[model samples]
Target: MLFQVGGQGTRPTFFEMAAAQQLPASLRAALTYSIGVLALRRPFLHKVLDYEDEFFALLMMILEGHSLRTTDASFSESLYGLRRRAVKIAVNKDNTQMDSGDRLRLSGLEKHQKVLSVAFLVVLPYFKSKLHSIYNKQREAALQATLWGNDDASFGDVDYFDGGETSVARRGLLDPEASNWTRIRKRIEAIIGVCYPWLHAGNEGMTFAYQLLYLLDATGFYSPGLHALGIHVCRATEQELMDTSSRIARIRSRERERLRGPPWLKALQRVLLSCIYTTLDYAQTGLIAAVFFFKMMEWWYQSAEERMSAPTVYPPPPPPPPPKVAKEGIPLPPDRTICPLCSQKRANPSVVVVSGFVFCYTCIFKYISQYKRCPVTLIPATVDQIRRLFHDM
Candidate 1:
């Protein structure tokens, strides 16, 4: 949808496009199938592709070694203009000659400028932020659905609208459970590929191209930086998952070249990518992390309680007769513009129903994702519990 919004023909399927490029029909069909399958699993590809300028800059840096520097330094700081983006207009005010208010009113030019200014400055950003939030929630929901067998739950499953048998039956090593029919198809393709050199390159090239893009974070700036960093860590930790006796690992270790760079570089990556990046990426594992942390905390508390011979859930919350409650009600309600937690004007107001507290959405969510507690109340909270507070005009 985002890609469509960017412009039509933005997502030209590889089938017809490859054919036009003079690729063999078979290869074209294969690539189209593969990409179509990829789209179904990862629908956000459109948004990623929508921000083409950033990717183009990165590509030029990699391929051409230099790129033009523009005001749009990063994708997050998206530029606004009349071309494609919303246009900006400045409202002029002059009290000198006949004035411009009440009876005098704004001039036709001023009125149009004000409307355009509000649309570009306010409407553009607010809508984009909401869209981004929705995209992130979709991802978090998909992850939870996978881990907790909640595919049947409201979270929904990874869906593909269309795909060929080859793409669906096998996503190569990414899907180890290739059906028997898919295996037969692979064998047939391999035999034909041997006869036609272009077929071999064409088929392999499609997957390789997609993999390369995925590795380089093709949608780099649009996504959270930590996700790309975590992936690099996983790539470095490849050998961690291999069994000592695994045939492939043994073969590679025995005969292949392995470069051990500097000890310092290795240590740096361990701390930077493995530790920090991986922890931030764990925010996606919303439910899983919550369950895991409490389980560990419970075990520790039980051990401590056993030693002390105390009977309780574990260590209690804060020592309290609890904060004293006022018997009388306040004269006025809390400030709507200011966040209770931050004691500042809210930018993106969100509410914590359990604690009856309001805060900036990002501030509260990041804190909750990290500590799983409301900052003010120290009460348990989850990302799902944060409700966006909207005002109707």
Candidate 2:
């Protein structure tokens, strides 16, 4: 009798179990006969069957003392071949199987065939593709998040998607997993480690080519003293530095020649070379700016300290103060000719002799500091020269 459930026959094959447990050793011995007989007669149903249910039914019958006698050798072989093919198809179609939660009761032959079909076609392939996609997506998301920042709006909303939490719970896209600060720090450290040697080796050609624009200030370069100082500082290790740079270049050339080989070998060499070059370039530019700025700050500090410490010498005797004029005798200029400094009618007006422009003494003094000449006529006048002219007036 076939396996029974609640007094009704049920499919005996279990997809999760090994073939030995689902079908007896006696049936295994007759597999060749049964397989052959089944194929020749084409005894199975050909409809769009629920294959897993059908597999369970056939497996149940085989287990329930249904034997293929050896006398019928070809018939047994056909049956065995049909069983194997059915199992393969069943396992491969595992993804389409109703979830365990949705499975329904089956009876006798139907139950047996369903289980065999699922094991051979459904369950196996389903897990393979599912696991593959899961890991592949995780790896891809990690790479994207590493290059570009996080994508999630919030971890709070991760569980709302229809396909369930698995979609967003994956760590790669999350903020905690994709830290830009950490990556930047690692990159900075790698750059410093790669470029420090070239800088320390005092490779002047490379250093000057890379650092010249940054070393001197734009305005200071116009001054002959400052320009000479900058050039002298840069040429400190002239001959020896040049020789060292030449040797390093020769070494790099020889290394490149030695590395040239087969396509794959050369490709690997170029990738490594490119990474080092890029890293070094970033390091050199940043480090040069930092070093030059620090040196300027140091020079400023030393100059300030020396000036503060230097002795102050007495100058020649101070000049006598100018005599004050009587305010009543001074004529006030018209309101339209207001003083530039105080923005009031010019009291005690004085004609700027160079331009014949009249203004308060205070206004003319303030204007002369900025222009060193009359604002109207553009005639040159020093403060002393203007003071002498005013005294004579």
Candidate 3:
């Protein structure tokens, strides 16, 4: 309705407007998740988290205020090459409305328009959220009364009430479910439900109507907030959005030409300017891409496979229990010729090199082969370390 006639130069596409809105929503979701994680580590952050809506409103006010002050655009709008301006309506000689051609050439938003636009952008969402939260709590309370009120109120049994004064008892049964809080909530809902539909319907109907208008000639704003505030987003012209670096380059160029600097210096300046322009152009897109990449990496690292494959450190096994060593060799009887291992007269005597203990050939051979240690001193001895001894009978 504000611009019934033809639109101004190059209106932004519907997708661009939608993308701008999505950026802030995505950022809010990410911030909420991050703050929840931080709340566990810092006790004071719990208070910040408790008043999340207010905290976010303050943050948006700062960001949007700075952006509008500098560039006449909100943070997201400026990123997408758009800026806000108040709608300019004019009357013709016959008191009929004129076309919007001249209106497009208007300078900027008026003082009241700026204040109202920012307030609507920040406050509308908070108001809507509080309304929905109240509705949810009321619904939950009503459900709890229906499900558990009888037990909570110390009723003996429904069957006991069925026999005596059926109508009176049935009425009393319903009484417990409608506590003072529930009755008050019901009354308030009834009052609002009767009177609020007209305003709510008008707002929604206007929003839909504006979308239709946008399709016709991109006349009205795409965002409901801007539409309600009597403002629209327009494609910012080059002159309006001149780069500061470009201005600096122009001044430097005049100096260079005046002084006749070296050719290489001019070429180097051109390259640096080009680099700066490219970085500024891609900065928003790159930031969004980087955020998604980090989220993807976080998801991948949290997967079950990553957890199972994670390495764990363990202490080394204790050194093999000192091998049960005996200081003296195996005890021998008065007869020095007895075999200590088999406890019998020595035959085919053998000596172990590791512990210098003597035993029967078969006994020492089997013991060294099976256990790989001396039977007397428990020293490490192998089958190859055994030697057969020869003596005269």
Candidate 4:
């Protein structure tokens, strides 16, 4: 976590905080003043995109991720409302079964927001690199054009392929690429995102959710996204989801299973986390101002009391340990069979992390290698997701 300053990670060295990925201001709703202040002020918060290696950070992500799941769910509901509006704009008041499929697909896409988020996160840096290369070339061309007194020719006039020869495409994730393949890839990603939702839906959405939640500032995170989803959910009628496969019911059931605590408890945790986030926001914005204001207040109090004593406000109680783990380490619907693969008692129990479902260790490891998807969800996955589960009888 870089080196801590008085237990704060605001300023760590380059090597120490090496893996921490800094995100853009645009993602956090940069327009809002509240968000702006928080962004400007948080000196110690490294805005970590991935800190899975650190145990405390991992624990924090798990706690934060679930609390965020509630926030995300609320936000998803809001987004649907907006989508319904757009749909109405095209075909006003068309209540066909195909429309129901549209609602279901939209709902599914909203649920898989984290998966899309990861796609964007992975794409953006490469996109930036490509843009930078394009910009540099354009600048160099502009310079040459000006030097030759051909000022009429602009950077936009710069040719991509010199000597009219086709440039060979580069490969790999980081390579600067703009081609038909990118469009094809996006379409495929969209299909998977809507149909299957997150890669880790069972565990507080996907791994991407953690990054998004962390990237999203607490104060500014809620309103816009939630407003959009709320509209979609509110606009869709019971008949909208009722016409076909009962998709809403399935989605709701999955959500209930995903939540680690009771709904109310989970909501409370999010509320508290939001409050803490707000406090952090405040700290970030008026840090120096707060110190000066406190100094003046302390002086005034000292003068009034005719003494040199400092104020004696008791420190708040230590926060309760995060209720991250379940009471039994077993999922709810408690009496169910421990292994889904064999549908039997716990024998070599393991977890398929892609779907967050337990199975026989060997069964899942072998199954994932062959199928490359979670058996329960039928979602694409890899063998790396199979991990042993340790639960005492």
Best by lDDT: 3
Q: What are the lDDT scores of the predictions, listed in order? A: 0.42, 0.42, 0.68, 0.42
What is the Å distance of residue 274 in model 1 from its true position? Answer: 99
Candidate 4 residue spans exceeding 4 A from truth: 1-68, 73-113, 121-137, 144-393
TM-score of each: 0.16, 0.15, 0.50, 0.20
Best by TM-score: 3
lDDT per residue (tens digit) for residues 1-393 in model 3: 011123357577666666666776766666676677778898888888788888878876766664565467776777777878777665454545565433444457776777776687677767655555656665666577798662223346455444435544566677856555666876886555444556567777987777677776656677577766677788777776686336545655664465435888777877776675466446546645655655765688678677888887789878554333476756555677888777899899989876666789999999889988788787888888989999975
Candidate 2 regions off by >4 Å? 1-237, 291-393
Q: Write the per-residue lDDT of candidate 2 for residues 152-224, one digit (tens) a residue.
A: 4434665544443455446435764465665675566545545544543554454343334323322212112
| lDDT value for model 4 | 0.42
Q: Give the deviation of candidate 3 from the true structure as CA RMSD.
A: 18.7
User: Considering TM-score, where higher is better, how would the candidates rank from best to worst?
Assistant: 3, 4, 1, 2
What is the clash tally of candidate 1? Answer: 0
Between prediction 2 and prediction 3, the one with superior TM-score is 3
lDDT of 4 by residue, 241-351 (tens): 343235434644575455567789978866775576555334323433443455565578779786546567798999665333234343333545666565567677777
